[model samples]
Target: MMTKTKLPNKKLAIPKKKIAPKFRDAFIRFYRYMIFFGGRGGSKSTHIAILLLSRMMTDEYMYLVYCRKWSAHIKDSQFKIFQDCVKMMGWQDEFKFNQSDYSFVCLRNGNRAVAKGLDDNQKTKSIAEPTHIWVEEADQMTFDDFDTLNKALRSLKTQNSFILSFNTFINELHWIRTTIFDKEQQYELSEQFRNMDTYLNHSTYLDNPFINQEEYLQTLLMDNGGNESKIASDRYGLWGQMPNENPWLYAFDKEKHVRVIPFIPSYPIYLSFDFNKNPMTVKMFQMSPQKGLYDSFVHMIDEMEGTVVLREFCERIKAKYPFSPFFVTGDSSGQKKGEVGYESKHDSAYSMIKKHLGLSDKQMNPNGYNLTYENSRILMNQMFYNYPNLYIHPQCKVTINECEIATVDEKSMNVHELKKDRGTYAMDHFDNMRYFFQKYFQEFARSNYHATK
Candidate 1:
C-alpha cells in the first residue's frame, strides 16, 4: 500500500481543434462510396475538399486526387478547393501547384492531389487508377461516360474511396437511383463510411449551415410563384419535370383511360401533320369556331417509314377521317451532310415533298415567327399548356411521348450536348403535328365553323 502511494497526478488534455461537422464526420463514416446529395449551395464541394486535405495532413504518401470531367475544367473549379483549404488549414507553401498540368501536392507530406474533367473519351482513358475519386456534377455526364471513369478507381488496392457530389436536374428515371437509392441494393461505400450502411445521406441547401440564415437570400428571393416546381428543380436541387410538366404527356394510369370521348361535337374538320423519313407523324383536330380553339376529341396519328409506306399510312388516315376540308401543318430540321457532303435531310425531305407529294406550301409564315431563340422557346413551350381544345388521342402514345421529351438545344449541340439523332424521331412526328395545326389555324376563322345563320 505504501509503495502504491499515488503517482504524480497527470492532467488529461483534449483536442483544441474543432471539426467542421460535415468533413470531420465524413472522414470517420464507414462506406466504400460516399454520396453528398443536396440542392445548390449545399457546401458539398467544400466539405469533400476539406476532408481530402485532412487525410493528407495526417499522413505521408497519401494518394489524393480530385477530378470532374476535363483536365482543363478541373484545375480551375476543383483545384481552387485544394489551394484554398491548404492555405486555410496552414499547410503553407508545403504543397506544389503545377500551372501547366493536372497534378499537385504538399512537399512536407508526400500527399498529392490531381484535378481534371472528363470532356472526352481519350482523356478518360489516360487516367491512372485513383486512390480516391470525386465526381462533380455527375448528372451532366451520360451513364456510359461516367462508367468509363470508374475503371480508373479500381487501381486502389487499400483504403480507396469514391465520393460523389451533385445537383440533379434529372430525376429517378436516371441510373443513379437504381444503383444507390433502391433499398435492397448494397454498395462498396459501406466498408469505410458507416452512414452508407443505413441509407443515402440526402442533404439539401437548407441543411447546410454555411448558407445565409436570412430567408430572403438567393433562391428564397426568386419570384416564380406559379412555377414552384421549376424553381425547385432549377434552384433547389429538384427535377425540372413537374407531374404534368408536358400536358401532352399521357399517364399510364388505367383509371384515367376512357374508351369513349366524353364529348363529341358536330364541327368543321381540321388537320395537323408532322412528317418524318423514319416514322412520319400526323395529328387531326376538330375546330370550334365559337371558342377560337380546336376540339380535343377528334385526332389521329400515323408513324411509319419509307415514301410509299408512309404515303400509304398518310392516305389511310385521311380516308378514315373522310373530310376534304383537312389541312396539313408541319416543320423540318437542318441535317448535317454525311459522307456525301452535300444537301441535308431537310433539303432531301423538301425535295421529296415538292417533287412527288403536293403538300401544303406555307411552312414558316413570316407573320407568325418570332425574332429570337428566347422568344421561340417561350412560344413553343407555351403551346402545350394554352390550347384548351388540345387533347391526346387515347391511342397516340408515340406523339404523346414525343411532346414530353422532345427538347430543343437553345445553344448549338455541337459540343457539350452532342447527339446527331438522339431523342429525334419523336420530334419529327411532333413537328408534323404542329405544322398541321398551324395550317388549319391559318384559314380556319372563315370556314364552316362560323357559317351558322
Candidate 2:
C-alpha cells in the first residue's frame, strides 16, 4: 500500500506593499476583460498571477483558467510563473499542486487554478465553469480560439472576467484590431463581449522602476539595424508596421529624402502628365543645374488634376501657374490617336493640351516619349536614394503617401499593381514625377562631374 499525504488548508495573505502602483487596481477591479499589451519586462504576467491568487483565496467557488496556445508550453511558462508568484507571496503551503493534472488547488477554499493548453480539445471540454480566465502570449492564439473560449465562459453560471496579455511583436495580419476591436465589426463585438467592458493598458520597461537600464541599452545596441518598426514595437510599447519588403519606391525614406522648399517663380516649372478618364494626374518639378546630384535638390512644388476633360485640366494649370514658364514631358501615349475632347481621333491628348495651355513645341521635353516604365522606376528609385536629390513641398500630401506605401506583388514580382486600390489615381502622380526626372535631370550627375573636371 502507498502512503498519501493531504495538503494543509490555509488562505493566502499577501502584503499590501508588494503590489506595484501600475497593478494596484488588478487586485480590486473585476472587469469583464482586461488587456495588458506592450513590450517585455513589464511584469504583466506577475501582477496578473498575484491577482488570480487573491481571487481564489476570497471566492471558494472560483475556478481560474490559465490558458496558452500549446499544452507543452503551459508547464514551462504560465504554470511556473504562477507558482513563483505563490511562493513569493509566502503562500506555498496554502496551495496544493497536482503535477499530473497540471493544477493548483486552494487548501482553505475549493477554488482551483487550472493550466490549459488550448491546442488540446479535451482540456477545453474539462473546464466546467470558470470564474476568471487568463490567456498568456495571446498573439499566438487565433481569433477563432478567442471566440470558442468566450462561448465556453457564457455556459458558466457565474459572473466571469477575462485577462489577455501579449507582446506587440506579431504580424499586422494577426493584430487584435483586425479581429475583436474593429469599429466596423462593432455589432459582432458587442454581441460577443456583452456589456463589452474592456480595460486597456500598455506597459514598457521604463514603466517598471526596477528595470536595469544598462541591460536594455545593450540589447538595443545588439538589435540596431534599419528595422525602425521592430525597435518602436519592442522599446516604446507602440503599434508598429513592418517595412514593406517589396515597396514600389524602396528608396523613399521620409526622414532622409523629404524636404520642404518654396516654389520660385524665376525658375521654369517642369511638368509631367498622365492621362486617364476618371482622374488625370500632373506633377510640377524644377531642377538645380549648378549643383551635383548628391548636393542638388529636385523641388516638386505642386500637383493639379481632376476628372474633367483635358481642356479643363489644362485651363486649371494655366490659371494656377499663370506667370511661371512651363516645360512639359509625358508619356508617348498622350500623342497617340485618340479623341480626348475633339470630333476625330487625330485630335490627340497632346494636341488638345498644347492648344488649350498655349504651350509651344519647343517647350516640351520629347526624350520621355519612348521611356519604358521599368527604366523610369529604376531612375526614380536611384535618384531618390543614391543621388538623394528629390524634395517635395509639405502641401503635396497625396503624392507623399502614395510614394511611401505603394507595394509590388510578390508572385508576379512587379510594381504596376499596388496592394491597395489607388483611389483617386494618386499613384499616377508618382509615375509622372519619375517621368519628369528621367526626361530632364537623369544624367545630371555625370554631366556635372565632366563639366567641373
Candidate 3:
C-alpha cells in the first residue's frame, strides 16, 4: 500500500531507543501485518501511535480506530512522550476525551479513528477499508476471533494492514503458526497475519535508548542487556511458551504406556511392534492423522510375563487390522550371527515373535528403524512441533503416561540426540517408540517437501 517493498530498517545503532513513535511509522509503511513485542517498560504504545500517525500522514486522513477489549483500559496522554508525538506531529486538536467518551481523528484523509471493540469486530467497516489494525496481547484471542473481526478491515484497495502487539506468555499452540510460520498455506490460515514480520522489525524496552540504564536497568539483566529468552520472546516477535508450561519439562512429559481396554473397531488399524524382554510387549499404533482414531492407549506393567504372549499379541493385532498394513520393527538383537551363544533366546526373539504371530518378512523390515537415539529426538521434535494430528488411542493409557513422563538421557538431556555428549542406561520405553515414529517420519521425510493434503 505504501508503494515500497521495504521500509528502511530501524536505526539499530541508536542506544536507549525510545522512539516507539518512529518504529510505528516503520511498521505501517512496510507491510500488511506488523507485531510489536517488547520487553517490560518498552515504549510499545508509543510506537503504535507513531505508526498510526504515519498511516494517516501517508494515506492522508485514513479512517483509523483505537481498539481495546475493554474501553476503560485506555490510559491518558498526560505525559510528554505521548503529548510530544501527538502535538509535535500537529494532531493537537484531533483528540477528544470527555469522561468516558474517547474519539480521535475521524477523517478520510488526515481524519479521525473511532473507538472500537472485538464485540463489534465485523461492525468496524463503516469507513473506507482500514489501512492498518493493531492487536495487543493477541495470544489471548483465538484465530477464529481474529478472522471474524480483523478481515472486515480490508480496504477496497490495498492500504489495509494489521498490527499485533503483546507481552510474551504461554499459549504457543497458536493458530497463527499456519499463517506466520508457514506462508505457503495462506489459504488454510487466516490472511490477517500473513506478512507481520515485514512491518514489525522487533522491539524491546532496551531498544529504547531513552530508558536510563542507572535508574531503570542495572546489575540485573532486566535493567541491563541480559535475560536472553525473555528478550527474544518479548522483543523479537517470536512465538514462545512460558517456563511454567507442563510440556516444557523433559521428565514429566510422557504419557504412561497403557494398552487400551475398550477397543473400538472403527477404522483400518496398523501395529508397529517392538518386542522387549521381561515386559514382552507390543504396541498397536492407530494411523489416523486426518480422521480421528480410537482411544488406543497403552499399559506398561511392571510385571514381565502375561497370557498375552508375543504370538497372541501379533494375532490380536492382525485380527484387528485385517488386510491393512501392519508395520513392525525389532531390536535385531538376535539377528546378529556369531555371538557367544549364537542361538540364544536374545537372538531368536524377533524370529520367534514373528513366526508365532504369522508376520511376513516383508511386513517387518529394518528400512525405517535404522536410526540412533539422537535421530529419535530430532524425529520426535519434528513430529511434536510440526505435526498436529499424531495421537495414541485413549486406551493406550500406559503408553501415553510413559511418553509424557519419559526423560531424555541425563548427559545428553534429550530423547537421544547426542552431539558431543552421551549418557548411560538407554531409554528402554523410549527406544520402543522407534517403530511408530519410524513409519511416520520415513514417509514424511521422503515426500514432505512436495506434500499436499
What TM-score would each prediction reach against the true structure? 0.52, 0.49, 0.45
RMSD to the hidden true structure, all candidates: 12.7, 14.0, 19.0
Best TM-score among the predictions, by candidate number: 1
- Pitting candidate 1 against candidate 3, the one with the higher lDDT is 1
For all candidates in order, the CA lDDT equals 0.49, 0.70, 0.48
Candidate structures ordered by TM-score, highest first: 1, 2, 3
Q: Compare the candidates by lDDT and give the number of the best one.
A: 2
The per-prediction tally of clashing pairs is 29, 0, 70
Candidate 1 stretches greater than 4 Å from native: 1-18, 59-61, 70-72, 183-199, 215-220, 223-227, 230-402, 413-453
Candidate 3, position 410, lDDT:
45
Give the lDDT of residue 372 in candidate 1. 36
lDDT tens digits, residues 196-311, model 1? 34224444556566557355335444644657665675456664443433232222232332132322335534444344444454555554554444543323333333334433
Ranking by lDDT: 2, 1, 3
Report residue 274 deviation for candidate 1 (angstroms).
Answer: 18
161-236 per-residue lDDT for model 3 (tens digits)? 6777666433332444444544554212245433343454445556665667444444334532555665455554
Q: By TM-score, how accurate is candidate 1?
A: 0.52
Misplaced by over 4 Å in model 2 are 1-13, 155-157, 179-195, 220-226, 241-453
